[model samples]
Target chain A: MSKESIILLLFIMVLFIIGGCQTQELNESGVVAGLGIDLEEEELQVSMQMARPALPGQSSGSEPAFEVVSAKGRSLSEGLRKITLLFPRNPLVAQANLLVIGEELAKTDLALIADSILRNPSIRKNAVVVVAREVSPKDVLNTQVAMESLSATAIPRMLRNQERQMGIYQEVSLEEFLNKLARPGVDPTAPAVTLIDSINGKAIRLEGTAVFKGREMAGYLDSRESRGLRFLNPGRIQGGLINIPAPFEGPGRVGIEIIRSQTKVEAANTDGQIVMRITYIGEGNYYEQTGEADILRLENIPVLESICAEQIKSDMQACIKQAQKLKSDIFGWGNIVYSQHPAVWAELGPDWEEIFPGVKTEIKVEFELRRTYVTDQSLHYQ
Target chain B: MLGSCYDLHEINDAAIAQNFSLDLLENGQVAFLAQTTQPVPRSETGETQPSQNISVMGTGRTAAEAARGMFLHFSRLFLWIHANTLFIGENLARQDLTLISDFLMRNRNLRFQTCVYLVCGVSIQDIHKAMNERGFAITSARGITQQIETQAEELGYYTPLANIELLERMLTPGIEPALPQLTVIKEGDKDRIVLQGMGVIKNNRLIGKLNPEQSQGYYYLQSKKKQGGLISIAWSDSPNAMAVMHCTQFTSNTRPFIQEGKLNMKIDIKCELQYLETIGDDNIYVPANQQRLEYLAEEKIKQQVRSCIIQAQQLNSDILGWGLTTARYQPGWWEDMAAQWDQVFPVVGSQVEVECILCSDGLSRESFRFN
Candidate 1:
């Protein structure tokens, strides 16, 4: 080879080496999928859930799908350093999907826990935030569920299901949750997670809700209350089921599947007495019938509707009552008042909590029964 | 020139962050919380689980300082590009959003589309902890924030408040910024992060909020990217039966007028919707019934707009940007009253004209074909 050609080849090789050495190799560092925080015995506990990519020596034919390690220290940075001491791999969270907090930690001052998670430049802000209930976040991080091989993957999917379904639960990210926490004249809420013993075995189910009053655990809403609150909120009702007494069917109950519904909230302030009017316009189809009387009689449809409306009202009332009793404006009634009557709201802004309970509310429900299953009459009569 | 490079580090020596949050410390300093990913190696046993992250914190007098302090004892380089969202805590948002906003805007790694959330009722620390939890309760699900921002009107009162857009609104004249409200609710076994509605921010502070219903109206008047909204109307005066419409393809045209030296706004809204469902005894097969439904929609929509305007005036935060719209139409009049927008906006009267065209009702109008 000529000397010039040899120099060119060496130059190209040098360029390749320089370019490739700093490039990140996937296997060198484990991919981070999730993170968790908990305050244990006045100590900071940080946990990491990582994916096990096959690497040398440890890969040995097969490898565990995930590796979780936690460390505790006096400070958050100390806790984080201890995690590296406990685990062999460096946690890379570029692709992580979620962050979790133990209920115990959530109940305490949150600003402390958030400082560590927000300061790091390596972490993204879009990961979903989940609060563990009746269990430490670490326990939740350790358990693996079906549908997704990793707990991190499965949990986000489960959250999506909740958002698309009956709205019995809610999903929030770090940014969105913090936004609510910062804003005044409004409170924040999130869905609750609990380990349940089901027919399929121990699994994670997001149920009810956790109501917050100024960063503290103020109250809660059951599944029914959640559904009722969803009805009150002006949003799309994607899929939900409501059951009512089928008196015409002789003491049986019937279920109606909500295809879509719309709610309107209007508030008026007259002479300082606030009157809030709520209207629920629902269009649903008859999905189930354990009743006897032929609801297809056309005349019975109105009765069924009235019954449905009554049941919905009761559900809404229960949720509203709880919110008022707890003095937590989960429904944003104070905001509504402020929006409708800004001048009046200016006066009531500081004392919203005092006036929230006494504000009279009127709830009206209207049901449009679109259809009654495939057959006009229940199969029992047929 | 085969020179040795000294700055190269292995990927294992770097911390990759997935979630980032901003808060204020007690000493009036900027505090950062980052949820970073940790790669765990598999043991000889072929069993490897996935999805693990670690949180690192830093505190400094300025946001940048605190972010830098996060690496006090850590030896790895911190990467900022992977974070997907930025949360401003209650104290951070209330004190001065610019504490984090100025840094995030200047950051070269972070994108403008990063979802920015206003923390209302909970602490960012709790949010970070929950973001790391598994088996998140349905009620407490950390929902897809991107989806919520895009389809904010789905719950009736938000527009996509991306970082760039939010900053522009804060800087723009005759307009204020708003963001999706995130809160944690505890009910029984469920502790959920609910995107309740919109938080109105004026002068870099949260002044008020738009409830879900008011949020729907706010979207109609203020937001430009109007997708569709869930509209409910009373079919009759009896309040017995109602019709629900899922409307899309919305367009709003606002006409500003200088009447008697006072600001008057006439908003003309045009939208098409498919009748999704009705809870009334009225039959849809008759064309007259369809027209009646449309008329009811028009009236209901007018009422909705009126209430929305009323709310905007009450806040004295022109979130609807009515002043800006008027400015676009009448530059001379806008200049005359622009400085006095705060006063003019409160007394400004609006008239709404709605044309709701019910294009299609789903197949098989009646429950049974025989009927």
Candidate 2:
């Protein structure tokens, strides 16, 4: 062929390659932003959140912006294969923001779902995992809140908000979970999620925590119990409220908002007996009350402090009781014993279960009521 | 390059995933869930854009196969570069984290800093749906971690651990790793996610945890420098009076030594605090009050640091990196104690010295005594 003819052929070939590349773009792939898993009849029920992008101020037809596709199979891998039967486009999972599992699955075997995730070149390892409160994993994928277009992202966003704002729960990524599960001294816990119907629309909420005894679901911690544990755990707390009966006898309860708080739990091993001493120091003010309490008087300050201290101690004790009842070391007493007294751990490590329940625990709480939020006496009494 | 390279993937042919989760099903299958955003074409007059986020889930005995399964029977490719948080169900975490870590580490799209968590009580699917609604999806990057980070700064305890850091600690000897655990709480009208505590790890099995106070001490000992957090101290001159000290700057230096053939460590710390509130109607700025506050804070800090050391010794997990410290500062001693470090660590004595400075008295010197 002539030189000119060869050049024309090369140019045409390049154009063809570029056209091939254009076709390879994301044209046919269904972007999967979230995944849900449920155990039904000994089968794996897999759910996917498919995103349908809308134009910036354009009118897209009556088609829903996103679609949820689910499939069931003998195994999770089989479920994925079955999902393809429902989805016309290739399902993309790299950016999956949220992972939801049905309660039954959580109780059955949570480990089976994580097999070979580390080997998947396309999966992001940072996606957060949550437990279903009462809803099925497939249905959870279909629900969405008002502010967010995708419940996958919205759910995590809300969870992060709760963790940050209330210090209720932090991000529980796969790596963190695995680390906890593989460790001996600490049991793993994840945020529990529930579906709620609000006036705004369908919304998903992170209700509390699911406590795990080894690999199986053992129990759960309520908000109050979670809060009590939060105060005992060392982290920055934005604030929390506690309601107590009026320092003086009255028909109303007083609410105190703890603006700042700190707690310390120390383990003391003496002779053959091990005891844990918990001390909580807090600073706050009387937020609201229905009855009158004179907090401004120097004498009354002690009364207020005592009442607040009593309430805090109770909160801490309640959490401890739950942990003990479940026989799950959610508070990490095992870790405390392992770190503080290695010799004791050596003897008790194998038989920690029996010793954990009878372990001695004491609680002490102190509060500094700063300003009474304007008046020392309740408005009702005034 | 928008459809530029002949060998590259085309944008229109794939979807960008925002979130991903993996759970263990009863059938020993790996459940993989991915959240993605699908873009819609704009009309001549742009108006009325609807929802565009979706979730896709699949299961495989292994992760790679399941991902390939997601790509099967579909026209477009699944792009995972934008995926954020990843979660492993509770059962999977206990079974084998190394397996999942290996799979995730191999992924080019999985960033070293990506946030990872273990789902305990709830399933991974519930976490995905807890917030996604109306087509709006929140990726792992912009999730609740931001809130935890902010509060972590203000509280100066229980900081979030990243994937890379966690993996390193899990492998590194002389130190165990800690992870931020999360839980769900149902409020009056809605459910909320909350921080449970630090999941303390040792011997690669879920064992126990560090309660807030113990966690605070753990962080305090581990922190190279402290910025801001509150400390409550017993106020001066009164048994019932208490004072809150809002700390600002914290500097610490620890020195390890072998005295009389016994391992010993001493920590010297300097901290500054501003008076936040006083429980009693007393002048905290006075000379006597100032001395009392300083003493109280100092004593509390010293005890806290010492307690944290004891906790580390008990768990047989040196989360404070004492082994690392001795290795860096006292290499010779560390070398001799390296084999016996685990045994010696629990016996090693720690002495904490704290000096607290009351930087400010707030807006007033005296309590609300207008007389």
- Interface CA RMSD, all predictions: 25.2, 23.5
TM-score of candidate 2 on Cα atoms, chains taken together: 0.47
Residue A106, candidate 2: C-alpha displacement in angstroms: 38
Q: Across residues B52-77, which tens digit of lDDT does each residue of candidate 2 receive?
A: 55565555555544443343112245
User: Model 2: how far is B246 from its true place, Å?
Assistant: 2.3
Top candidate by TM-score: 1
Cα displacement (angstroms), candidate 1, residue A231, comes to: 62
lDDT, candidate 2, equals 0.68
TM-score of each: 0.48, 0.47
Global fold similarity of model 1 (TM-score): 0.48
Minimal lDDT window, size 10, model 2 chain A? A373-382
